[model samples]
Target: MSTVFASPSENGQTSGATGGASTSAASTPRRSAVAAVTNRLASPQTINFVDVPAQEYYSTNVFTKSVMKDRLPKSVYKSLVRTIDSGEKLDPEIADIVASAIKDWAMEKGATHYAHIFYPLTGATAEKHDSFLSPTADGSTLSEFSGKQLCQGEPDGSSFPSGGIRVTSQARGYTIWDVTSPAYILENPNGTTLCIPTAFVSWTGEALDKKTPVLRSMQALNKHAQRVLKVFGHTDGAFVASTAGPEQEYFLIDRNFYYARPDLLNAGRTLFGAKPPKGQEFDDHYFGAIPERVLAFMCEAERELFKLGIPVKTRHNEVAPGQFEVAPVFESANVAADHQQQMMLTLRKIAEKYGMACLLHEKPFAGVNGSGKHVNWSLGSSSQGNLLDPGDTPHDNAKFLVFCAAIIRAVYKHQDLMRAVVASAGNDHRLGANEAPPAIISIFLGDQLTDIFEQIKGGGANSSLPSGTLEVGVDVLPPLPKDAGDRNRTSPFAFTGNRFEFRAVGSNQSISGPLVAMNTIIAESVDFCAGRLEDALANDPDSLNSAVQSLLSEIVGECSAIIFNGDGYSEEWHREAAERGLLNLKTTADALPHLASPENTQMFAKYGVLSARELHSRLETYQEQYCMTVDVEANLAVNIARTMIFPAAIRYQNELASTCANLKVVGFEFDTETLDTVTALVKSLQDGIATLEYAIADDSAVAPEDACRHRCDAVLPSMLSLRETVDKLELIIADDIWPLPTYQEMLFIK
Candidate 1:
């Protein structure tokens, strides 16, 4: 945390790598050897959590029937289990029994309080902690909870952002029981609390929360998926479910450094700083050794997540300095989203315990790799299972081919809608970047399947997927086998081994938005295919395979434009996509309006994913959110310029001018060139500020969209230019006068 600067000798050589007298005077007391060893042991290490026996992990890890069996009666336990697995309505009579069981289980785990956890439109989870205390008639107290309290909660809705759905005057909002997601105990520094996942809604109940729409979308998908499965000649089975494995990427900066930057604290990104002298250019940071501080945070985070029943599968260094990624195994979509939310909060709390701040911003630092949440999604049935799985005999698996073709068609036809799912003010900095996918949404089927789809289109037979060994070109390397195909990182939606990885979601966003769109779109396509096949079978009473083939053939033809097997980053692909009539929305403003488009409105309405009114309201909400974010950032830039940047520049200019004057008076010639350069730069910055100020004040004259565009695309660029000039001044100025922490200090601390 010390602002220690390197010193230089009179000969312009760096003073010997020893601490200067001034630096030594400023140093704090040294840590004990025991403390240092403790710090070293905190670094991340493999836990072999996945290798735990299934019987022990699955049976004892989570709140399963075995745990509930000892606490509740047979009837109540069965009812709760049915509700959790089958998505049935929660029976009010069973709430007290279930709550009591949960309370006992949590208390055994050292929990003293309970919280009703819910997801609001703020893009994060909200919870209110309350102690489980009930006063008795005597001088004693007994902890107790009633059926009504367990089933419902009334939290103050006035504080949460409602997107105009809930006005402040209407303070009534309800948190209804979402029995599908399991309740777990959150262990904190002070004490532990029972966290129950619930769906929040307003008095009017127009889907005022993220979880509500996700559940509704899941149901809509189930209805259509059931119809599709029925057409495939199946009945008397459980409903279809969607699964997601969201790979989370984030940055961990030392708490001392992060706290020093106002921009990081307020906006979750660095507003002004020159690029670091060394960045990710050499690509050495990827899979690099975990820094001691960051490693400790990750290890503790993983352990906590495991205890909460979140299966943390992978952890590694990412493509940039201070960037890291944590990926969990796939779970049902709703459960996965809930776990993701839980994981984020857990990461933050654990990071603080390690004296670090975990940044979930899409672009915390400019000129380095930005973070993205890769949503790996797929459909799985309760009985027949895995609709997207192309079996060993893929050509004969009519159901798989039909479902796969449905996803392609859905993505191709609704690329804009897909883009709309991940569009956000923060993510505008990531999409189309070197490390992130392009704004154009294209499906990467890999080389093997691209050829297969082409053959299917041309009425040709499927090719042999010959398995082969992959060898490294070095003698020391061992031979490795190759799979069906490789993935394309540049593609917005790429099909990995088992799931479609939607790579455009922002790090800070909830996975619910994108998965909802994906599930609904897939459901709609499946419904369309089912109706077609049912009609054909009824009319001809003949081959189901031929009927499915015809349906898939037509779908692939209509939506073939969205399929891209080559490099999506290449300019050639963009041009080809343009020619194929694909929609490429490069920014939040460009993509958000598509949410209310007639095509999207019709699709959602047909599938009952969202009503027309709800769709329009969401679009408006996003637009308003985008505008407000830009406004806040623009205002921050203005404040920094006026208070911090401008004053520092003027002080430096005065110092240079004084030095030149002193040299002239002392009968020695001094170059005034540096002084003149500083003067010119200051003038340019002043002019840029004036321009931004005028545009900001003219906001009343133009529309909100225009104003937002002016701020984001216009004023933002000008602000960057202004900062460039000021940053140059900082490099020349004395270190003592530089008020803000340098980029090196901010990025490299600890």
Candidate 2:
């Protein structure tokens, strides 16, 4: 009930938050936390999906290709299809027709405003909304959307985090509409906005946003993939595209508990809490029956997503209490990235209406499984089908092996780059823990594929790995397919039957960063394969099979160090991985500098995914974000501990001393055990708080590396040590007087 001190990490981030200056919560009308959590229908959201079949509502909000066909002129529709299907440039003359069709479709969906949405460097979505109204000479308005307005919009580059790309007095960043990602109406209770996904860039044409690099990388990948397909005798192929299906995991707690804890409100995590008496220890929470309240939220969330054309297919309980996951089916990389950002936004907003807060931080709590976004990715073309799949025919299988070999080569050569892409302050808390993958980047080929690759290294793969079925003894349960082997959850990157799952991405991050890196690296590797095979065909046309085998063997022989089929969580694997020369970057600070390394920058520049200047700008911006996050966490720890925990502990200490004195006067023996324990923890808490304050103040400069090193070495240890003391106090202190919500109440009450 007392005024909580500053939560300076995005302080005042949530509504009615207490800041550096104290403010009272006692006056606010808050029901008992226990009663508030149990009220299942406290914030009822009326959505009935039972009657509305998915077929009727799915993609109804989007300006689908079907709608385009119905409205667009035949020539215009055909031109648009060529651009969408083949990655060809949109014909400028057809822009007016396309714009008019999209406007009509969106207007029919009840959209009055349109937004050019772009993903900027701040790791968040950006949008500038404009009314569809144009003033008439008679002072009335008419709905209008011009080809120029639909194609490009100007947003101030200097206002955003462009690193050094934009200086003062420069306000020129262009958001060019990306035709590949179709426009959709984003639904809001008040109104709907027509959202056009676009690529953001500086005036000089540098890639200034996340979407731009991803688009460029996709183009690079398609060009290189085409070169390889040409060598395989597919003269005319549809443009190949890497696809992504990001499985988002998150935790949801009641709104009362979420707002009560300043740490949770501003930082997206509980900075302080004792380990609960019960946790995910029993493993009962994993795949457990969904809580009724949570099930309703999921149902509504998925229904909203379906309307927007996001194909969410699975929803289930995850490994920790209150943790859950939702996975969408795969889509082209750019669309997937855009949908992923939308999905995060939708999940958080919908949770609020259901009276819960969706926690997307990688590690929202301690001593439990954290969250990760497992990105299932693959590359293929409509003409060639999925190149990663081991097809039924021998020739198809051989082509698959070549593409698979390219991925292996890419991962092995650029392990550091892979690690660097997923690096973030929130993720550093989860990686290398038992719940998530280790920092060392490696490939899991499964048993069957591993055997084939081993045989390729020996000489050639003479046969295919046969698939089998699992025979359950019970007659009621049907046989299950024995997949290429059981999946290795600990592997950072694992190749499933048809795609590789990048499990290192944090739950809160956009999938764009990882997809860009994956597409670019694989693009370079495919180019390498095509050059070698092209030379072989030039020399001897009849020896095509021999050339393919030779290329696979060469890749396997050299890049075998990256292929690990064992338990990736084992201590033995860490030592073995080190011996194998894989780079194990344990922290975001350690990994981010690699983004600006000459090799990485050169690769980005070579593929036209990003210029050197663009790459450097990204590196600078991300490093700044990393350092800022650490500094914020450190400061919050010091402020919360000194102001909240220390005072509460002292009050209890006073009460204990008074009780012992009063009992002595009443002629009774007072057991000093409780008193002594509280006294010692309070003193230790004070000492720890002091240590953290000193650490934070000492290294307050802006140098990215030193600042980060100080955080990792000094501030983080002090914060952890302080948390240990505070957590002990939490166990001993009276519940009525404790300042923050307990983990048990936050994690289990609902």
Candidate 3:
């Protein structure tokens, strides 16, 4: 059991973690110093991280003293580096030296305070700020940060969600330094603080933070991957690693509209908006010119990301009107997860500066394309490079084929686990909606590979595809360009050249959860293959190629059910998937329990990815998260329907009645049609609101999980019905009489 805090309720009681009511710099001299650094970067044209020289800045590698230069002795610096990079325990003797060095660096950069930054399972980072002011014996104040302070901090654990792991009375929790993620200085109008990334754990030692499990899972995969590499005679290898490049998609709405919508403010999604008249229908905004405001926000956000060592590589307008995407260059899974958390934080802060609110909620608006994070994954041996990439002669590369077949086998065997990885209350609205991949998990290998596989299964083709490659005078197209394989966007897990893109992951969800599942499952597959090869080599070293071929043949035959190279959104593919026996676990309730299934438990335990207790604990946690989310949304819908929509409709009805009476008294006969429409809509709104209220109350009367399902399937529908009637009222009601912003105003406002 790891001692990390898992949710917000676990640490909410912690004092000084939320930052002392955001103090301004005018109160202290340190604030003035920090402002100078921030002021320089505030100018848009002067901010440039792309050309920032690495020599004078902090390096990504933690084992070097370049980041802590001019602060510590040679011996103390090396000792701290060892503790940070090699997982060595921090020495007490070097504590003062290290602390003094950090304080000096931060002060030089104009920082006056510091905070222990930790991820507390609220799907975001948390920090309780503190000033660096300490009283000296002579009465003068001294800014101090001790070695112990740098390495550890205590945060009250009872307030964060511990999945019933601990009670409020037992609230002691500790934050330990996460040396892998570098500490950075954060500047604010109030003051500057050196934020150190740390892992939060409970007193009882159950894993509490998201990063802990991710780190553990990474270690698990590395061990198994190394074993597999050893079987392939890679003797010099110390590690085999996995990398991820997550393409994040999101929507940006004006902050004014965002503030006006209670649903968006409370739930991070709008539960009551009618579809915009021109919602992505014209196929515009996709890769269109970036809005000036959005462009400025992106520049600042990217600069912050770069300073923090997040390699953001690409940005573009997404499919929907307000939608956008940012893709980072590939990094190790652990670093990638850290960077993602930081990136979201940067986006939130910077978007505010541009008067926009970043919506990470999977379906912020109904009928518009929701967000998703396409996780591009690949594995490589320390000695062997990427095993997924085929060389020039792919047909003859048995190693690459074997690795590819292993992934196919893994995806086939644990398709449920893969589906469960991205299952969430928010994502339920996006999956199988034609914009994203279907709920059914299937691999899409392009046409060229499809043909190659078919040929291999059928004992190789008699006629081959162009035996020799050639150059062309018109070099717009590369000679042969490797096979022009057909692409499949429908499959949840698709092989795209050198890596597999897991497109089923939702944008707002943490990649660590899915990567943990992927790394564990793939490691299991790799272990299985290595075992078979080891035995075969021992039996007959002379027939190595034949053994490899036979192994791949068996894998391909068994895992063929998991492959589909057609449209995922098509009804035909769903039926075909059903016929081929694929599990379509659509909802979180349907998918989460599978994590505790006997087979999944065994597979995870086999590779030491997660113990059965840990797996069961997480399953329970996910179920709870799903239920709580639905319950909150259900409550929000009820409130909006009753308070916002119901009152708005009544006002409109009153206006209509007043107008009708005035016309009748004047002997000018008014149309009864509009009056009748208003009356009927009011009645419908009353009925639908009553229905929603009944469903919400009844759902609360049942088991928590059942209540959640009721909210999704029953309560949600009633809310939508009520919303539909109210929306009709909006279309008919005079613009001056309507209370809330209309869809057109909310969606089109810059």
lDDT of each: 0.77, 0.86, 0.74
Indicate whether candidate 2 or candidate 3 has the larger lDDT. Answer: 2
Candidate 1: residue 350 lDDT (0-100): 81
Candidate 2 wrong stretches, greater than 4 Å:
1-31, 39-45, 392-396, 700-702
Q: Residues 482-588, candidate 1: write the lDDT tens digits.
A: 77787788888998866789999999999999988998888888778878988998988776767877787787778888888788778898899889888888888
The per-residue C-alpha lDDT of model 3 at residue 445 equals 82
Relative to the true structure, candidate 1 reaches a TM of: 0.90
TM-scores for every predicted model: 0.90, 0.95, 0.86
What tens-digit string does per-residue lDDT give for candidate 3 at 60-167?
Answer: 322225766556788887877665444455677876777777777788777888888877666677887777889889999988788888878888876776665656
Question: Which of the two candidates, 1 or 3, achieves a greater lDDT against the reference?
Answer: 1
Candidate 2 on 341-421: residue-level lDDT in tens?
Answer: 999999998887666789999999999999999999998888888888876433338788899999999999999999999
Worst 10 residues of 3 by lDDT: 1-10
Give the Å error, residue 564, model 1.
1.0
CA error at residue 464 for candidate 1, angstroms: 3.9
Instruction: Name the TM-score of candidate 3.
Output: 0.86
